[model samples]
Target chain A: MSEYTPLSEVGEFGLIRLINEKIELRNSSTIKGIGDDAAVLEPGEKQIVVSSDMLLEGVHFDLTFCPLKHLGYKAVAVNVSDIAAMNAKPTQITVNIALGARYTVEAVEELYEGIRLACENYKVDLVGGDTTSSHGGLVLSVTAIGEVAKGESVLRSGAKVNDLICVTGDLGAAYMGLQILEREKQAFMANPDMQPELEGKQYIVGRQLRPEARMDVVYDLKERGIKPTAMIDISDGLASELFHICKQSGVGATVYKDNLPADEQMLQTALDFNIDPLTCIMNGGEDYELLFTVPLSDHEKLKNHPDISIIGVITEESEGINLATKHGNSYPLKAQGWSHF
Target chain B: MSEYTPLSEVGEFGLIRLINEKIELRNSSTIKGIGDDAAVLEPGEKQIVVSSDMLLEGVHFDLTFCPLKHLGYKAVAVNVSDIAAMNAKPTQITVNIALGARYTVEAVEELYEGIRLACENYKVDLVGGDTTSSHGGLVLSVTAIGEVAKGESVLRSGAKVNDLICVTGDLGAAYMGLQILEREKQAFMANPDMQPELEGKQYIVGRQLRPEARMDVVYDLKERGIKPTAMIDISDGLASELFHICKQSGVGATVYKDNLPADEQMLQTALDFNIDPLTCIMNGGEDYELLFTVPLSDHEKLKNHPDISIIGVITEESEGINLATKHGNSYPLKAQGWSHF
Candidate 1:
């Protein structure tokens, strides 16, 4: 074991200088990045969208299994997912992080390295933020700002009756990944010498540890000239998000159980854990995939998209949100979102 | 004793709904507020500025003496201070808060009430945020967004030689307030039944609990046709901030000790604590007051202002930053900023 330099050796100002020295601004709208009271931006004619998220250790993630780099990446991706859900292009982000005294300068650099990588991958500039010390576990708060054309941004209340509902990518993988991690932790705790079995669980575990925002889908949609009528990211399960769109839009939805997309690995893992695959699809959280609605006329344009699933259709409010089975039976949809409280 | 409802009773979504119901959007630029994936804004033809801050309970404040409402207001005020330092009008803010399981619904409501009051006072719209549960102390993260006309924004790197350095309001008050609170806390800890004996320290205590951002001075300076060559908020003491301005602008500063402003209460309290009054003024933190520089030609326009003090003059970079005594003596200014780590 090697001795590492503690955070106190760098101090707050030194830490900020270290972080700032490596940051490169990627957006033209960013007038000032760091080393200022606030970051300045010139958005010109584009409307701005702002989203914030806070991740706390022991609540949002367990550092025992989650790497700091992946945690940092996931934190930025979650906020970017919100901006992408608004049908916007992310431009800048401010990260406010609190670290315990036990953390080292090298640890802080590793976390920021992941954040910097995410910023580069997403084409967003790292702007201003606050750095402070905490007595408890690590806490990270991120605020992402994005831009969209005047009339192109989508809202949760824009869905109309007869609209076609769509979901990007497969779901339930991330939640199952969390279950696998928890089980492996338990097994390791029971026997310290045990080699945890994780060979075939790479994909599901990756989904849980590092989820990517569907910004690519937002760009692809813009290039294809298809704007979503209503959009939201799947952070609190698909059923819960559907409820949000329906409630805000004063409409209802009918999603087919068979149409719900799931990764094959996630389905197999759910069965291995004696959990229903449909339950994982409907109520599992933190997918970071886009769930949206579009006009029925856009069906021909989106039907054959490789990664998109035509999951459902919007209906009148009186009809109620329902899930249709392959056996021609229907049941009112129920949502059990992950409630931190 | 009354029965307090647990935070778990409302859940995260219910808590969000409760908060959203009380919020009223105050800015026209806010196209959409709460109940969305991301808040939308239209800052047409204007440049935007963003600043973020995270305050941890044990690190930043002691909940035993500090009220929840004041904590929330101070959180907003500090972030807004960063925006003020950029010479911009605050338009919106997004708050991300993590509450411990011990916190009740009423406690959360009290916190947001303070945030709501600050938003109303600052004329900023409460746009969006994330609320989650924490295992440790309470955490409040605020991100303030403001706008300025193109080329009107001030940065810390603009000061040049011969520019007159100005600071708004008195300093050392907030730091002294913290001292008084700590003394009173210690007294209470020694004897549980003893009164606080805070009869004469109201002003200083208030300064610590609720420091206001000097947006009024920004408006006043603009009205009087004085644009600060450089600006920054005094969060980590005046001397430390002066170093930032000098380092960024490639200039030195010579501040007169006699010109350092301090409230009479703070001066008296410094003597009461057997501490040097000069130390309290130069090295005290959390003033949230603007320290700015203006050209020599603008002196006549700002010299008569009641709250503004002409503390120093920018000099050539080789001169070094110094403090001049009233007795014709000069000393190199040393700054011991608050280092949490």
Candidate 2:
């Protein structure tokens, strides 16, 4: 067995001192990072955007299959996704984690390593956070701070009729990935000696375990001088996010089934699980892709973008949100996103 | 029983709508609140301060005696206290909560009601949050955003030799309050039908359950033209926080035992519990009062303040941090704050 140091051996203050030694502040706006009652930031002329999200063990992830590092990265990524949806650049984040008695100092370091990696990848500073003990399982909450130029920020209530609806990258791979992992876990549980089969499922599994926020798409749109009329990250599935956009904007949308983007591995895994691919694409959560609307005039700028899919068009509220099938039949879309409750 | 609607019946979206309808944004800096992917704020010409804190059920509070509303209020107050310690005014807050299946819609409403009241009292906008179901008891995380003039913010690393050590209100009351509550709980467990006696302990008990952030002191200091040389909120006891300021500032402090502020009820409770009052005053946690240092020149401005107490003085690092007793005996201070590891 490897060395295991109980958290009690190094008290909270000692643990904080240990963590503080390794943190490096990356943002110029951060006047003071850790070691203060609160982090001080000078956002300068930019408007600040704040987003918060929480993930709980057993409900959000199973520690048996999910590594602490990936879980930490995913927690930050989900909060960053929210900031990305606002057409902003993430600058700083504060993470609050509660660990149970079973966790060791090494375990916390592993978790924080992932958090640090994500912070580096996203170019955001780990400014401040709180760490405490929990009685049940690990609980993590991340709050991301971002900045957007005046009048450049996007909102979910800006979509208008005749706007083109777009989505970044692909969806449903994460959902299919979750299915494969669950299946493997079930197989492993049934027979202790059997090795779980996960061949040819790396893409789907990775998507489920380590999703990335579409900051690239946000930057690309800015470089192309295109501002989204409305935007939301696909955390609660495509259909659910579209509902939020439509309801907030007082408009309806029509998405063509053929235009829905799906990764090859995701489609294969969905078929292997005998589930409808469209269901996985439209109702699967945690994709962290941006679902947005751009003016029809900007379609020419985005039409040839390989990573983007123009899936729908905004319509009057009376039209209702609908999905057009390959068979030419239109049906109202139902948002069945993951509901923990 | 009153109407009990399970969370599943309303779904996540429905619950969000219910919560959104009741939130009232109070800050002019809040450009957009709730509903969007993130909340937007325009902190014109001011530096922003961010603070985050998390509270876990069974760990931070005992549900057996702690009401849901008080817990909710305490969560916000604690985070706000962190911001106040930086000499900033809290402008906005984002809350993330995970509740178990046992929680009902009414229960959630009660929790939010307390949150809403805190928001009103602090004049902070409840801008954004994430709500999800957990497998265990409730988990709450709150991030507070505040603003201060670019050069007006205080840090724990600015104390200089000969600075006056000041504290707001009284200390040890909240810890003593907890002792009384625990005693009552044990008594109640021994005899379930016995009515709990809490008549004479109102002041101390209120201090424990509904501790307020010392934002009033921050404003008062500003109005009186006094900028603290160093400041920190006493969430982890006087001795521990003093250690932080001294270590960060590279100075030592001499606190007089006779000057340590104590509430009458707290002193009485300590006697009743057969605990040393000085231990409660110096090592007790979660008082939520401001412990700070100011230049010796500003002592005259603060000397007559009713709620402020001049407890000690900053000294050269070689002097060491010590507590001077009334008997002319001085002993090195020991920090024994709460360790939730």
Error of 2 at A21 (Å): 1.6
Q: Which residue pairs collide, candidate 1? A: none
Alpha-carbon runs more than 4 Å astray in model 2: none
* Tens-digit per-residue lDDT, A1-341, candidate 2: 65998999998887887777888888899999988999999999999999999999999999878999999899989989999999999999999999998899989998998899899989999999999999999999999999999898999999999999999989999989889889888888898787867789989899989999999999999999999999999988999999999999999999999999999989987887899999999999889999999999998999989999999999999999999988999999998787788
| True-vs-predicted CA distance for residue B153, candidate 1, Å | 0.4
Off by over 4 Å in 1: B1-3
Q: In model 2, what lDDT does residue B264 have?
A: 91
Worst 10 residues of 2 chain B by lDDT: B1-10
lDDT (C-alpha) at residue B283 in model 1: 87
The per-model DockQ list reads 0.91, 0.91
Model 1 score (lDDT): 0.93
TM-score of 1: 0.99
lDDT of every predicted structure (CA atoms):
0.93, 0.93
Residue A256 lDDT, candidate 1, scale 0-100: 92
Q: What is the TM-score of chain B alone in each candidate?
A: 0.99, 0.98
